[model samples]
Every structure is written in C-alpha cells, then in structure tokens.
Target chain A: MIEVSGLTKRYGPATAVDDLSFQVRPGLVTGFLGPNGAGKTTTLRLILGLEPPSAGRALVHGRPYPELRDPLLRVGALLDAGAVQGDRSARDHLRWLAASNGIGPRRVAEVLELSGLTGVARRRVGRFSLGMRQRLGIAAALLGDPEVLVFDEPVNGLDPEGVRWIRDLLRARATEGRTVLVSSHLISEMALTADHLIVVARGRLLADTPLAGLTARFPTLEDAYLSLTSGHVDYRGVA
Target chain B: MRRALAAEWIKLRSVRSTYWTLAGVPAAVVIAALLALHASSLYDGASAEAKANAVVSPLETVAAMIAQLCLAVLGVRSITAEHATGMLRTTFTAMPRRGAVLAAKAVLIGATGLVAGLATLFPAYFLSRWIAGDRPLVFNESTLSQDLPSLLAGASLVALFALVGLGLGAVLRNAATALGAIFALWYVLPMIALNLPAPWGPRLGAVMLANLAFQLSGDPPYPGALMLSPWIAAAAMFLYGAAALTAAALALTRRAP
Candidate 1:
C-alpha cells in the first residue's frame, strides 16, 4: 500500500503539486490521469523519494520509501522508458540493476524473456527503438519482483501488440495482489486497465474515483476525464 | 547499503566507458615510460645530474595524470549520463537515500582508483628499468620512498580528479562543460600561472594545481613555494571535490524530477 499525505511541491513562483493527498491500495491498478504539465510525474517523484516534498510525506507499506530495506523489493519504479545506459546492451543493463538489488542473474534472464527482449538483449540500448526501450524499462522494473510498481507513460510509443502485452502484464501483476500505479494520457486504454482513477489538473487533485463510476456517469472514460480536467487546462494561442 | 554498492558495481561494469578508462592506464603508462626511457638514454650529452633526474619517474606521474582524465570522464559519466538521459531520477527512485547513493558511488570510484594505481606503478617501474640500461632505477632503497609516494600520490590525484569531476558533473549536469572546466582548472590555468616571476610568480603558481602536484611529488624534494603540505593540499583538493558533491546532491534531491 502507498499512502501520501499533504504532499506539496513548489518551484519559485510556480507551485507544481499543491497539498495533494491520496492512497493507492494493493490488489488493483490505479491510473493517474492528468493533462500535460499537471504534475503527474512530479507526484510520482515525490512519492518515490526521488525529490523531497515541500511539505508532508509519502509512505509505502506503512514506512517512508527511503527507510525501506531492499527498496527494490518493495517499490519497482520506471520513471522514464529510456533510463538505461545507451552504450550498454539491454541484458547487461538489466543485469546491473538486478545486481544493485541483490537479485540474481537468473532473474535478469527471466525478465529478459518476460519482456520479450531476449532476442535484442545483446544489442546496445542506444540502438533500440522506442518500443524496445519501453520493454527494457519494464524489464528493469520487474527485475526485483516488487509488490508495488510505478510506471510513468509505459505505453507512449508501443504498437498494438506491445500495448496488449503491457495491459496483460500489468493485470497479471495486479492479480497477484501487487499495487500498480501507472500514469498515461491514453484514457481509452487506461479505461480498460485501471480499477481506480486519480485525476489531477494544474497540480491539484480534481477527482479520485472508481473507474466504473466514471464510465457509468459519462458515456466514456475520456469524456469524464475531459469534463473533470477541461476547466484546469490552459489554452495557449497559436503563434 | 550493500545492495546499493552491488547496484553501483553493476552500473560500473555495464557501461563501456568504465572499461575504456581502465584500458587507458596501461596504455598511457607504457607509452609515457617508453618515451621518457628513450629520451634519457639518447641524450647522452646531457649532465649526469640531468640524466639521473630525467628517469621515467616524472613521466609515470605525467602518464598517471593523463590516465586520470579518462577516469574523470568515467566518473562524471557515472552520474551525468544518467542525468542527461534522465536515469538518475530512476536511480534515486530505486535507492532513495541521497547519502547512501553518494557513498556507493564513492566506494566504486575509490576501488577503481586503487586498481588503476597498481596497474600504472608496476609496469612503469619495470619499463623504466629496462630502458635506463644497467644502471639500477627502482632497485635503490632511497629512491623507493620517492617512487612509492609519487606512485600513491599520482593515483590519489587521479582518484581525486575523478571525485571532483563527479561533483562538477552533478553541479553542471552537462558533460562537455563540466569536462572543460576540469581541464582548464587542472591543466590550462596552471600552465599560465607557472610563467610569472618568482615570489609572486611561484606563489601564484603555488595555487596552480599542476605545479602544486609537481612540487608535492618532490622526487628530488624541491624547495616549496606552494599553499599547503602535500597531505594538506591533498585534503584541500578533496574538500573542494566534496563541496561539488554536496552542491550536486542538494541540487538534485530538492528539485522535482
């Protein structure tokens, strides 16, 4: 379980995430929805303790993230898809992350097969396509077999098959009683995958509701998301 | 902390630059030793004092310095590449403790420095002996003290530069600019300072790290005009490196990803 309370972050004159609070429970997939620059990424960073909160705190499994023993075993995070060293082969890339967490090389090979990256595992990450890099990122996240997983825009450039693969993978992990928090702009795909929704706009929480209620009230998930966030989105003039 | 160390080790092995840096030590040491050996033997017309002083000892220090650039680049690359590619956010997210992460990186760098020092010392010692003809170089007990300190100091300089490079990389986050600043501070500025007239000139040169480095080696134990004792100078350089690290950690940990 991930519990965040009164989380706030400000950048000089601009307040990025303000007084935000929410809980992401286990045994479900929680989709974090927000417009561009809505502080979705910032919120994840704060929760994972990548960046300190301006106010308040975030706890994972009843303890702060930094205080956790074997954090990789507790929280598996993929903040960006292409985070591996470009000159390193995909297999070597995963191997090091696994080693970092005391995970064996066998597990590294397992993630390689799981992510369907065994074929291109020997190829350098710099040469990978966007979809290939996405798989590598997911592979790294799953290396430690963590109970809570955080993915920021996992399906941004994936093909139809790749998208289906991730959807099934996330669902399977959730089925195993793991907590999953994924941020994405693809409301349609998220509608099918997410059990719960946390919507934000301009760094403020707008809605934290079940997916069924959102779809039942509005014709579709996208329509509901648009309605909730439309007012908060700023429209800029085209030059 | 153990896990973080293991993770950093994995990171060190995975990157090609790490190997490249390691490879440079031997290549540089061998080349510099050979060149110095050849020059000493060929210039027979030179004074006995010149010949004795002109042994491959100084060249080993120079080669070690050249090898350090590679290590510095590797050290900076360890964090900066992650920052440039946005991997550091993921690393912090995985590990979280700012001090632990920095500690892990420092351990890895120190281990690498020790290995690099050993590699350069042994080969340069023998190569100089071979090229300097029958007149023993490293066999003399008196010279061993000078040679060992120079060896250790050279290695420490490399490690120090690597740490400083990491700190600068953290502060600047741009590889090219950080490297440029390190190069100018270590090499260019020192050269310019050495040209001025003594008292002030030597004083100015004293602060010039390169000259300070040469003075600190003291193979023949030259008269001092520099800032601090060798140990103190070494400590001061490390302190500057630490400041860079502190700045970087503060900059990164406070800002949102």
Candidate 2:
C-alpha cells in the first residue's frame, strides 16, 4: 500500500502540492483526480521520491521510497510516457533499466510482450509514435513486476485498443492484490477503471473515498473535480 | 554499486554515439601520433636539445591536446545524452541514491577512458617508430620504456576530461552548452591564462588540468624544486574529479525532471 501524509511541494512562492494526505490501499485501483496543475504530477514525484517533499512524507510499503532496499522490486512507476532515451532501441532501454535493478534480460522481454511492444522492441524510441512510446514506458514500468504500480496520465496518447489494453492490464494487476495508483484528468475512464478516488486541487486534498461515494456525493466526478480546482487554475492571458 | 555500474555500462554501449566517441579516442591518438612523427622528421637536422625540447615536445603536446578533446567529447556525450533524451529521470527512479549513480557513471567512464588510452598508446608507439624517420629513432627497450609515463598521463587526462565533461553536463543539463563550456575550458582558458600577470599567470596555467597532466608525464626525474611531484599532480587531478562529481550528484538529485 502507498501512504502519503501531509505531503507538500512548493516552487518558491508557488505551491504545486499542498498539505496533501491520502492512502492508496492494495487490491484496487486508486484514481488520482485533479484538473490541470492540480498537483497530480508533483504528488506522484513525491511518492516515488523523485522530488523531496516540503512537508510530511510519502511511504511505499511502510517506508519512504528511497529508504527501500529494492525499490524496483516493490514499486514500479511511470511518471511520464516520454521519460526515455530516444536514440536507444526499446529493447536496450528496458535492458539497461532492468540491469540496474539486478533484473535479467528475460524480464525485459517479458515486459515487452506484456505491454504489446514486442514487435517494435528493436526500433529506437525516436521512431515511435506517442502511443508506441506510451507502450514502451509501460513496458519499462512493468519490468520489475512490483507489488505497487504508479502511473501518471497513462492513457494520454493511446488509441481505443491501446486504452482498453491498459485498462485490462491495470485491473488484472490490481486483482492480483497489488496496489495501483493512477493519475489522470479523464473522469469517465477513472469511473470505469478505479475503485476509489483521491481528489486534490491546488495541492490540497479535497476528498479521499470510494469512487461510488464520490460520485454519489457530487452528481458527477467531473463536477467534484471542477469544484475543487476551479478557483486556482492558472489562466494564460492573451495580448 | 555493482548493479548501478552494470546498468551504466549497458546504457553507454546501447547508444551508437558512446561507441563512436570511444572509437574516436584511439583514432585521434593514432592519427595525431602519425602526424606528429611526420612533423618531427622535418626537424631532423636540428640540434639534439632543439629536437627534444622544441620539436618532440610541441608535437607530443599537440597529440595530447587532440586526444584530450576526444575524451572530453566522450565524457560530455555520456551525461548530456541522458539529459537531452530525458533518460536521467528513468535512471534516477531506478537508482535513487544520486551520489551512487554519479559515482558509478564516473567509474564506468574512467575505465573506458583508461582502456581507450592504453589501446591508443601501443598503436601510436608502433606507428611513430615506423614513420618517425631515422636519426636512430629508437624502438629499443630504453627509449620506448621512457615513454610509458607520458602514455599513462595521457590516459589519466582522458579520464579527467571525461569527469570534467560529466560535471559540466550535470551543471548545464544541455548538450550544446556543456560541449561549448568544455571547449572553452580546454582550448580557450589557457590563452586567457597567458595574458594574466606574473605568478598569477603560471599559477592559472597550472590550473589547466590537461597542461598540468601533460607536464606530469614528461621526464619523470625532476631537475628543479619548482616542478610538482607526480603523486601531487595525481592527487590534484583526483581532487578535481571529486569536486566535479560532488557537484553533479547535488545538481542531479536536487533538480526536477
């Protein structure tokens, strides 16, 4: 399970994630819902120990992520679909990351097949389309087969088929008693895939409850999200 | 540490540029050695003192300079490629201890630099012996044996340049800027150092990592108290490497993806 308490991240005077606290339990998909700049990405970065939190803590399996002896074996994360070297072939990219965790080449091939990227495994990531890159990112994330998985905007550039593939993959992983925390702006997809919702806005926790409970309380999850983030949206001005 | 080293090795090998840059080191060394030998032959009629001090020294210095650029390019390419392609984040995620990762990268680059340097050294020696003209260009044990320190120093400079490049990339996190900064430090800094006043100028010259490295290798026996001991030079090179690595680790860990 993933536990975050009073997690806060700030950029100078601008707060990206503020006093956010939520718990993601095992055996279900926990959807992290927030509008644009709702601190969704910042929260994930904190959880993975990619960025230090200004306050409180984010724990994976009862310990801070950096403190874990074998982080890849315990938690797999895909913060962005394009966080990979473009010049390297998909196979080699996964191969290196796998080697970093003491994982073998077989695991790399396993994830390629699992993410449906086996056919293009030899191609450099630069040649990949957005959808293909997303698949490769997913392949990298699953290389360790960890008990907890964190994905930010997993379905951002996917086709219908690709989207369905991931939805099924996530559900299957969660069904196997693993904790899955996914952040996205798409409410309808979350409604279809997530069992629980942890909503935040302007870096602050707005609600954390069952998906059904959130939908029942606010009419639609979209409405709930808007109510939380509507005020703090950074409006880009026109000349 | 072992796992991180293995991973960095794989990362370096998987990319075409890494191998290409590594290949360039020996290529530069051999080509420069050949050209230096050819040029040295033109000065054959000169006096012994003139040949040793003026002719061979300058030629060897040129060879060292050329080889150093190749090493610097390799070093900059190693880390800047990650930043350019956004692979650093993935790397950090896999191995969160920032210092360990940087150290592993330095170790891998250093080993690769040493091997490349050693490879170049033997080939250059043979090529120089073949093309360097008569006047009894000694291929004997004594003459060839004396050159080992220079070869070793060349290798150390390559690794040091690589570390310096890694540090520059870490600071700038841009390939173009890092390469430019490295060029400025390697090629441009010495010229500027020459224009400065008295003791300050030579002292500034001493700070030129590659120049000091070249001097460190030349004629192991010391004639004057002004010369720095080889151990002291090696320690200073290591100190610079450590400083660069510390900066890289801090920049890498503290910065956002």
For model 2, residues A70-107, the per-residue Cα lDDT tens digits are 57888888887787888899999898888889998899
Score every model by TM-score.
0.89, 0.91
* Model 1 per-residue lDDT tens digits across residues B1-257: 88789878888887778887788888987786677556656656677786576433345665676767777787778778888888877677667776678778877886686577667765766566556656434333235655676677666767767777777787788899889988987778766666566767667666554544544565432344555577666666666667767876776666544
lDDT scores in order: 0.78, 0.80
- Write out the backbone clash pairs for model 2: A18-A203
Which lDDT tens digits does candidate 2 get at residues B168-220?
A: 88878888898898888887887676667767766676667766675677542
DockQ of each: 0.63, 0.74
Tell me chain A's TM-score in each of the predictions. 0.97, 0.94
Q: Candidate 1, clashing residue pairs?
A: A100-B7
Runs in model 1 deviating more than 4 A are A236-239, B44-57, B134-146, B212-217, B220-257
Q: Candidate 2: deviation at residue B7, Å?
A: 0.6
